[model samples]
Structure formats: C-alpha cells, structure tokens
Target: MTEILGLYNYWIVIFLMMTGFYIVIARENLIKTIIGLNIFQTSVFLLYITMGKVTHGTAPILKASHGGESHGVEHGVEHGAEHGHELHAAAEGHVDLGVDAVKEVYSNPIPSVLMLTAIVVGIATTALALALVVRIREEYGTIEEDEILEMDRNS
Candidate 1:
C-alpha cells in the first residue's frame, strides 16, 4: 500500500531491531552479541533520523529573498506606526523582515544531534565490551559460553 511504502524507513528500523535482538538472545559468542548491540544501536539511530525528517522540508537555514537592515528598519517603523506602538529595532523591528514569504518546512535537528552523540557513546561502549571480551577469552582460553560455564563449574 502507499502508506506502507511511505513508511519504509520504519519497516527497516523494525527489521534491524528484531534481527539484532534475535542475535543478542540466541547467540552465545560475545563478539556476535556486540555486533548485535551495534545493529540495535543503528536501528535506534535510523528511527530518530527518520522521525526528525519532514516531507518536502529544507534545512533550518533562513533564506532571505528580500531581507536587509533597510527592509527591517522600514518594516519596523511601519509596523510601529500602524500598531500605535514604539517598537524599536531591537525589540520587534526585525521580527519578520525577510522570512514572511518563506513557507518551507524545516526538519528538527535535535534528534539528529542526539543520535550523533548516541553513536559516539555506542562506539565507546562496543569498544569497551570487546576489550572485556578479549580479556575473558584470555582468562578462559575459550570464547564459547557453554565451555566457559563448564570450565567454571569444574573449577
């Protein structure tokens, strides 16, 4: 359906989330579990990025087709005179100087910024997990969960 196709990114996020969860729950290898965690993290990132997007949206940058100091000053003076208020340039003079004609939607940037931070934290967590796994392997001489459990039981 059109609705289903329109939300394809959500579908991908769901698939990746499930696949990662399956790997984490079903696999015994620590490295594979780390990979699964990474996959799960990526799914979260994709979800956030997708949620932050807007249809036909542009960046949050302001594009001034008719904006300048003179325009702002003139508009401000006119607005003040019409409203019978003494609006100074610093108060409300430059409120709608150049962006009144711009009706473009802008995507939210907070989600993307938070996801970027999450990505860095995820990488650091993965590295620490892998390092711990390496130490475990060195101490146990095996990376298999069952074998390690058996070794522990015997010891």
Candidate 2:
C-alpha cells in the first residue's frame, strides 16, 4: 500500500503523457494540434519536476546552521580528498557529499530551474504557433489538416 501510494505521481505523469500523445497524433485541427503540444509540454514539465524531487528532501536552498557535524566519505572522489568534502568541479558536474554530511536533505534544484526556462520557451513557442495558426486560419478559411492540405494542393 505504501509503495503504491508513493508511485501515484508517476501514474499521473503517465496518464498526462498518454493523453497528450494521443491528442497530438489523433487530432486534425491546427489549433487542436497546438493544444496537444501544450499538453505534451505540460507532461514533460511535470516529469522533470517529479524526477527532481527527493523522498524526504526540502528545497535546495543553503541554510546556515551551527548543528553537530557529520561523518563518512563519499564515492567517485579523488583518492586524497577528505571525507564529507564535496568537490566543486564544474567540468565534471557532479559532487559527492559524504553520508549524513548534509543534515537537511535538499532536493536537486537544477531540474526545477531548467524546467522554468523550458516553460518560458514553451510559452513563447506556443504563442508563436498560435499566431501562425491564426494567420493560417485567416488565409485558408479552415484549420483542419485535410483542408489545409487541399488548399496547398489546389494552389
């Protein structure tokens, strides 16, 4: 029961993904297609947000605390590197905080930040696509895929 509960979000994500995929593939109207694209984008955003979440973690904000220290060495670090010391190697793009070193478990913020940027871009792209659709509708008198193709072939 607990395991299933934990995975409810995943199930929701899958449902959204499938719904969006179906819309994009099965629709004929240009506006509908754009809506489908938006749905698909929404699912992607949700997926990224979900993946970034930590089971018992908080936000990835650094807080000042004078609490007790931790102990343990992390893997994938240099041989001479000390335990509980994370590397700030941007080239490698990975850091290992030793076991229990970070008292407050913070969820990875990278995905959330990236998703924010993507959301902005997606909004702009969606707006542009809708504008193009409006123009297409005005010129062709219809937004259906078949009608647009007929118009093109007629021209």
Candidate 3:
C-alpha cells in the first residue's frame, strides 16, 4: 500500500480536490457553502503536503540539533567524523552523498513555499468571511442568504 501511495498520491489528491470543488459549487446553504469551501481549501493543502513528502530526502532547513553541520563541529570531531568529504564515500550504513538524492526524489521547494503562502491567504479569507457573517447575522438576525433575500424583498 505504501508503494502504491508513494506512486499515485498526486492522483488521489486531485480526486479529493475535484470532489471538494463539486461540493462547494453545488451547495446552497450559506453555512454549508462555507464548509464546502473549507473542504476545498483543505484538499489543496493536502495536495501540497503530499507533494512535499519525500521518502528519503532530508528537511529543507539546516538545524544544529540534527548533527547536520554545527553539531559536527561542536563535538570535537576530526575531519572525517561525518563520513568525510569524498564524493564517492558512503557512511557506515548510508548511501553516498555524492549523488544528488534531494534533486532526484524530493519535490521542489518553491511549490511548498507557495502553498504555505496560499494556506495563509485561505485562512485570512475564511476569517474575514466569518466576521462578515457575524455582522450580517447581527444586522438581519439570520445568516442564511435566502432569508436575507426574503428580508430584503419584504422591506
């Protein structure tokens, strides 16, 4: 299952996205509409998160705690403590660092960064919409679009 998931995760995410889009477009109730929108947005996030996942690739950020670079320097280690700098050399149990593993298997970082910005935009839109809903409810005593329409027609 893991193999299949790793292979076709993009298709699954696309399917979810289409389903959520259909729900958002077909729904009528205002609150239900908002829920559908949330689902659609979440599906997009899932797609990005799925793409960001790498089977063996390391994280984008360099951390001191993970013994990546700074940790090696602080441990009073010799020149070859961390597998040395030879391009063809491999660590005790790991693959050689000469090969560009990140470039080969990992998705691009630009997409991940763009998706994070999109998520922030989605959250901000949702919050602003909710605030508008609250204001509309206070003014009309109802949050339903149809009810608001009826009130407008009667007035």
Candidate 4:
C-alpha cells in the first residue's frame, strides 16, 4: 500500500491518459479531435519519460554510483589487493573493476528515443490532419462532421 502510494508519477500518467481518451472519444469537432489526439500523445510521452527516469541515478555516460563516491571503490580495491592476481592486474594498470565499483543505475534511453520518433510522427500526422481540415473547409465552408454529413447527403 505504502509502496503504491509512493508512485505518484503513475497516478498522473493514468489521469492524463483517461482525460485524453475521453476527449478523443467525446469531442465532435475535427479540431477538438486533433487536440484530444495531442493530449493523448502528451500522456504517452509523460509515461515514457517517467519510465525512463532512474531514482538517484545518472546518465549512462557517467560512472555508476555505489551509494557514495569512490569511497566504495577504495574498499573494493583493498579487498581485490588481497586476491593476488587482482593486485597484479591493478599494478599493471589493467584494473579489474569490482562489483561495487561497477554498480550502475543509468536512466534507460530507449524510451526517450522512442518518444522522439513518436513526436516526429505525431507532428507529421497533425500537419496532415490540419491540411485536410483546411481543404475540407474550403470545399464545404465548415469543419464540423455533422455539417459535412448533411452537405454530403444534400449533394
């Protein structure tokens, strides 16, 4: 229960998802539908970004944190020194990293990269939709679905 309570990011994502879904389904206007799609897109982005985040973590390019700085590394090296070959390896500059020194908490980048692609696709889709809407308006003088339907029937 307490653990679930701590996950507020998930809660926010869920809320956004529901709201976007409602807008996409309930709206009648073409412009409103696009706005709803954008909201839905934003919710998905938030979800991806939140999932990619690491708690007390750093970028993958940086060294991993083992709770503290190189303090853990010193202890690990001292331990390795007692292990014969490990000491020799260190002396030759061929440093063998211990578990503590290699402990990493990197933010996974796949989600962000995937989201970037999604954003590009979304932009293209939105531009296409707006262009179609503009063309429709020029031909029919209105952008509403009901009006278009009535015009189609009359024609």
In order, the Cα lDDT scores of the candidates are 0.81, 0.77, 0.68, 0.79
Task: Give the count of colliding residue pairs in each prediction.
Answer: 0, 0, 0, 0
Query: Candidate 3's residue-wise lDDT over 1-155, tens digit each?
Result: 99886668788878888887887788576667777787788889888777777667656653334345344333423434555563223242233321323344544576679888998988898888788888888999987778899999999
Tell me the deviation in Å of residue 63 in model 3. Answer: 7.1
Top model number, lDDT? 1
Q: Which has the greatest TM-score?
A: 1
Which runs of model 2 end up more than 4 angstroms from their true locations? 1-6, 63-101
Q: Which is the winner by TM-score between candidate 1 and candidate 4?
A: 1
Candidate 2 vs candidate 3, lDDT winner: 2
Q: Tell me which residue pairs clash in candidate 2.
A: none
**Least accurate stretch of 10 residues (summed lDDT) in model 3?**
92-101
RMSD of each: 5.9, 7.0, 7.8, 8.2
lDDT of 2 by residue, 30-64 (tens): 88888998999989999999999998998876553
Q: For model 3, what is the error of residue 7's alpha carbon versus the real structure, in angstroms, after optimal superposition?
A: 6.3
Candidate 4 per-residue lDDT, tens place, 1-155, comes to 88687788889898998898888898698899888888888899999988988888766554534445456556656866788678655543323344444466678888889999999998998899899999999999998989999999999
Residue-level lDDT tens digits of model 1 in 1-155: 99888888899889988898888888788788889999988988988988999889876565565346546667667877776747554345355543453465778888889998999999999999999999999999988888999999999
User: Total clashes, candidate 4?
Assistant: 0
Which portions of model 4 show Cα errors greater than 4 Å?
Answer: 59-104
Which of candidates 2 and 4 is the stronger one according to TM-score? 4
